[model samples]
Target chain A: MRARERILGRLRATALPHPPEPPEVASWYAGRQRNETRPQQIERLRSALEAARAEVHDARDAAWPAIVKGLAEAKGVRRLLAGSGSPDAARLAQALPAGIELVCFDRPIDDWRDELFDTIDAGLSRAKGAIAETGSLILWPDAHEPRTVSLVPPIHFVLVDVGTLHPDFHTAMQAGRWAENLPTNALLVSGPSKTADIQQTLAYGAHGPRELIVLLIDEEGAGK
Target chain B: MSQPINFHPVESFKERGRSVVNDPAQRKNFRSAMDFLQGKRRAQFPERQELEGLRDLASAIRRYSLAQLPTLLEQLERNLTANGIQVHWAENAEDANAIALDIARRVQARKIIKGKSMVSEEVDFNHRMQEAGIEALESDMGEYIVQLAGEAPSHIIMPAIHKTKQQIAQLFSEKVPGVPYSEDVDTLIQVGRQVLRRKFAEADIGLSGVNFAVAETGSLCLVENEGNGRMCTTVPKVHIAITGIEKVVAKLEHVPPLYSVLTRSATGQAVTTYFNIITRPRQPGEKDGPEEVHLILLDNGRTQAYADAQLRATLQCIRCGACMNHCPVYARIGGHAYGTTYPGPIGAIISPHLRGLDQTYPLAFASTLCGACTEVCPVRIPITELLVRLRNEAQARPDSEDATLRGSGAGRTKLATAVWRGWSLVYSRLGLYRMTSWSMSRGRALSPIDQGAWTRSRTPLVPAPKRLRDLLRKRRK
Candidate 1:
């Protein structure tokens, strides 16, 4: 017999009597955030992100490229990688400081995975939104901005607009209703790659980005 | 008396557990690791009411999922198929391993990089792959450490928790191509990174374990801190996800509470660094992600657990490792001592069903029924009650009236059954109770000093001078 039939058959044969209706789940937190105003949400998100060891910069709009450049310089990164066709990518390309090398995702990662894994010092991508409750960045990596742009590089740089912050993951998922139109992959990244495996010593950059630098776009003067 | 030391299939849990408890280093390691994890979980769920609400909600979600498991699994298969992904089913561990090996051979994969999958460990996947001459490397740092030491993961989340940092440093310095005897945490991580990076780039196939399989969207959710899961699923040409059938949920929203409690319970993190929601294989214009994605659902003995209403609670586990973290017996014995892929409280219950009760009698007996695991369980599995039930099942005769249970246990030694039976009979009779109490009190000095396994690590037990009934009667007089 086919494995599927046999397994499912056993499950059904041994199945216990269950209620006809599936039980209801508590979908929302009663008061996940004390205040839900745009600025307060941003403030809460920044602190939460910072607590997870992610560096959140208070610059947005036209100043994004300059802040990203400054971060790259601070990290001693010679090459900066980003996905193609995003407005953020265009702006970054235009304001490139002559010294650093910038590579955009035009070809398939299959063609350049080794180089991306080995030499790419930083990967900058745009965050679709931010979850304030857990301090996570929601990135719906698509054709233009592949998943590797946020994953492969040693330092992962994300562009987060303060207004896009949601009080918690549930609130964000509800508003997005991602089931209607979901990307191939959606990532909720709270911080840099880390491991507490060896004696709970807590080391960063085990297999992903060593550092996570967030360019928090405070378009609403939320910066304290 | 001459029994060769057998190790592979986890022979004799009592022997292994005794050795673990005897080692001061293992005891100290477990103490610090469990304390750190427990503290993180305590801090994560500070608000008592909120934490309870979440736990209740998580438990309800799991209950509802198990209730609708068959329908949801069918839905998941349909959705995944429609999303250009192949879904296969395995009836047992050998079947699952065979399917993987067949796929590997067909894909002509010489090198494979695997993310941390406890399920894979259950199937002994790496060994099977190596026997087929395929190099399957573990990408998770903890898993890699255990793999390097040629040992199984002692803890589920922190696989290398049994080993100290100095041991890890020595292993890395000796095993890794270019590394000194550096005890620095960062330097050690770098050494692992330098070695695993090449493997990730060169691997032909990526193997992962799904945390949650969303039936609503046919997406596989993987939660990780190291990002190796993402790499294993993205950098490779083909990605294979192996999961037990019970991992599916009805809707995407069901994930939030479960995910919330799972992270807080497992490692005390508010949320893991990365939560990858993979809906499909790479699209036509997509520049990254696996070209092919396959999810293999293994039933093994899970269906048997689901068949019985009382035993169905075993399927609700999300592999959070919270039960083990809080279990007093597990805290002292450690994961390796259990002699199974899963150790600790959850293991004590599930190992019987998965490995069969006859083979896992020692595992079932390796518990104190402390109820700490039940109290801390996010899904609120009545772990202590389950342990007691398993004990009864274990002691049951094969042809007994109660042996009708699908996963009903048998094979308790005749000696043990007689001892317990004799004690029970004597206690229930007033005549026997009085006679035995008087005799035991008078013969206290002549009590047996060697209490077998009980006295191995603990002081031997002897009767007190007076029984409660006798003392009360004397007071009344």
Candidate 2:
């Protein structure tokens, strides 16, 4: 304990510089001061949303069939739950084979209440964006974007727009404006949910999706 | 269901690797899994510029965070303690193991359900737990597979990267009798889930690894696709998190950048499925989570690495497993060949430092110095440079015969030293170099191979009739 204190003391002495807020922060505040002004953040968010939509459209056209076929192949996947925030989720639902239920939620519900809608074999949703460096899909849940669409299901399929893809973590945080108001829940999914707990055996779909498939839509390249 | 598979350390690693490499069926399964992942990652980024920019930003953040690690760690400890969580500092592997054991004893824990923690692997925590007569059950499915197989993780992110469905089926059949042997992936997963659910419910203590520790909020962040990490922290009566001291960041603001890098670089995902932030255990009136929360801050040679200006960058590693996937040597020989908890490029540099040059000398030479590992590193650590440093350190040991042989000039001490020094002097002066080259042309027919023992192992060089100096002389005339 004494040693821990000593180490802590040493650490405190070497704290990195935390410079004053940049001009952008002040500009953002100034914009907020003018009630009639168009908020730069909101505009950026809108543009990001538009870019995300375009990517999803392209992915739906190119990769929907294969994704549906893969999901259909899973043992228990009968229905897919998708979030309303994802522009592609609705389109993906329309593209699925007849009788395979794909439901989209615009808002959260009690776990028991949501469970009654359908037995979700898989979840299909659009990622807020994608990280290119690690192939991770990011999802932010809110009052409208329920967590169950990403969870609950045995297989989760995320549709990502290439325009929203960032190379590394730093860029992703910057673009997302993470420092301002972080979301309550954010998911960065690389692959299917997996666990290797019982004697070091690899098993997918332990507590979440057994399989995760992402459809990367090149909005500009595909001309969607 | 009975006893976990016994990993005999050295022999088992060779056996496991040989068997996995030989089995075509296993190879197909492993290849397909990796192929799917790589393909997804490739498809995720269409704009190369954007992806590159993100990588740069992520690398910068990690580097910056590690540079101020000591301060961040102290801040994190204070916040965690203020929130009623006990934080223990461990200087090395033994200290970490002892601390974990003491925690178990204090809680009177008979059974432990551990979430997948790489730090626990670094300290060999399960072995220590078993020695103390405590039953430690790995709750993550991938970890469970390696635990059952009695082996170590081949990949940092994917522990059972070397295992096949058939191998898993064989192990399952032996553990759970009367169960039909099936090579199907889903069947195996179902069996594992059913078995582990009971263990999660019954375990008295839960052990986990922290992804990020936020100093301002006193929160430990655990990012996972599976809810097992969540269950491990919440379901058990006591929750213990073991993590490296370098995992600390000064404020919550530092988390997003780190998260962005770790997730993207590890599996090429935008974000992990479940990013749970736990401040304390369950508060008053709370129904879930552990009653007591203990955070083990493991130094384990991290401070020593931090003290060295050249080595401090190694602490920036996020353990994303990108280096391993891209490393040609690691891809070919696999993880067990390295014989350390951490494997591949980062492991080659870190293991020798953590365990010492004597115990981990071979790891330094494990790499081909191909630079692929350095290229893919999320934090941009100069991995190849560090590996070279370790190699130099290994050669400098007091009892090193290899060093003596190289240092003694291979037999002809005086003549070799004088020749080497004279060559250096000649090279330093361009005019002298030209003069020597012109003189050498007079004896161009002499045996080049007979000049030194170093040339004895190679094909004899063709004697030059004229040097560049002689050509220059002819031009001048």
Candidate 3:
């Protein structure tokens, strides 16, 4: 353990008691001052939401059909779960074969059991907002929304309303402040749940859905 | 003899990528997993303006931190030492690896559990540890998958973006013999959780990557979705955090912006599921933690980049993987194709510099220069510009055909070559340029051919309506 001690010794030599100055923090808080007004901030938020929504819709429309086809080909996908606020989730569910089932939930439910939802082939939810920078979707836990609605199902279909997309991450947090009290649990998902734990080989859907289908919906385009 | 873990960077990358891409079932699994995450992220934050603000704040913080990195690192080092945490400096990959290996050997540690430190990946610490006969086990789910497959990560956030559930089922069936073949994700997670818990408890040393190293408090921050990192750090007798020198921020105040941005940029969460801040090992009154804490500050060519005025900006990267997620090239080919510890657009630029141009020349040519990576970079590293710079560097090699063709005095055989050379000569001398301009203006009456190769695929340049000299003369009249 001589090597450990030496490494530790070096560490000990470099340690100090407190952090550096507060300029960086002050600058950051100061920067927020420019867009401090609620109306101005809301307008910015609205535009950003519109842009994000449009992008999400475009991505979803391009990828959804292929995802649906792929899911249709899977072995055990009879019943699917869908959330409210999804643009085409209802329509898509209606379009499924007569024998298949679609269960819709308005919000998260604490009493929901994993096994009940686990048997389903897929779960569908509407994204509250999407971060374009990381391709992540944010989800909040609520009374009607069972946590397993997104996690237990092997296949997950997410509906992204084009109106609620953000280009970067900081904006997402700023929006979070608008919520009086944030939900107890929140999820930010980038890609399919995966692991490269075994000899550094990738395996998808390790503890969550194995398949992901994002449907970006442009409601205005329906009229077009 | 144990099979030699060959480190053929290129061939191995291709082989790994080919397997991942070819697996249709794996792709299905990835699609489903990403969909779930996307759904969750959306539900958490329904407003778009908030995310944008977070991004801006995050970018600003990273830029500020990078500007004062040298100072911040010194402060962090001092603070950490005062807190009874040992810190070491590694100038390069070899030094970093040697230092870590020496620590393991000193402890007579045969089993080491790692908790998702990407810096260790940069130095290929696992290979070094195995070479030294120390069993290195990855406790994180993603790292464990990579470890089991003998492959590297394809995505920084989700290392196994390319693998599917069926493939994992097959792998689990083979590796964990008693585990039944079940496509259920929960069952698989239970199995992994059980297996890793044992590994965590048994490991002699725990290694982790630092998310943020606060200079003010000498605290190392780790953010994770699972509690694995916490377990690995707290359960082991010794804890070692390996991180890049640039991870340091001057004070605790700089941390909020970074934390805000890192979470949103990484997964679009207001905050990660777990954010653990450890100031030092277990103190006198502390109940549980490692007996000793060690932090390794790895330069590994970062200082070289830091010294170069043009390259120093790159040190601002926070490893958020935003550029990778948005990059078209990375989306198609994945991370392994970059053939480096770091992958994606950032990797394309930084890897060659760190590994040497000769070893990583191909990576420089990997990008389409789409500029998307730069637009999304939390720290605004000018990734696309760096990629182009790397390309120019690659072209400068003596063996490059472009170099031979572009080099002076090569040949005047081709008409295009002669014209190019003549143009260059004329441009070099101001007197010659004036004469050429006069002649060109005089010859404007003659129609020029549209056959110039440069104009073939683009809009032909419009002849100057009139020379500046002509314009001046007309004005006098």
Best by DockQ: 1
**Global CA lDDT computed for model 1:** 0.86
Candidate with best lDDT: 1
Chain A of candidate 3 gets a TM-score of 0.62
Name the docking class for model 1.
medium
Mind sharing the TM-score for model 3? 0.60
**Count: clashes, candidate 2:** 45
Superior candidate under DockQ, 1 versus 2: 1
Which segments of candidate 2 are over 4 A away from where they belong? A5-204, A209-224, B1-40, B397-477
**Which candidate order results from sorting by DockQ in descending order?**
1, 2, 3
Q: Distance (Å) between predicted and true CA of B41, model 2?
A: 3.6
Q: Give lDDT tens digits, candidate 2, residues A1-224.
A: 76686655544554345622221222322332323222332233334433322112234346665556554654445666766645566556656766677666643242233252235677666678765444556776554445556655666666666667664444566667654444434555556666543323445677666566656555445332
Model 1 residue B116 CA deviation (Å) reads 0.5
What lDDT score goes with residue A183 in model 2? 43
User: At residue B304, what lDDT does model 3 achieve?
Assistant: 50
What value does DockQ give for candidate 1?
0.76
RMSD of each: 2.8, 10.1, 14.7
What is the Å distance of residue B3 in model 1 from its true position?
A: 20
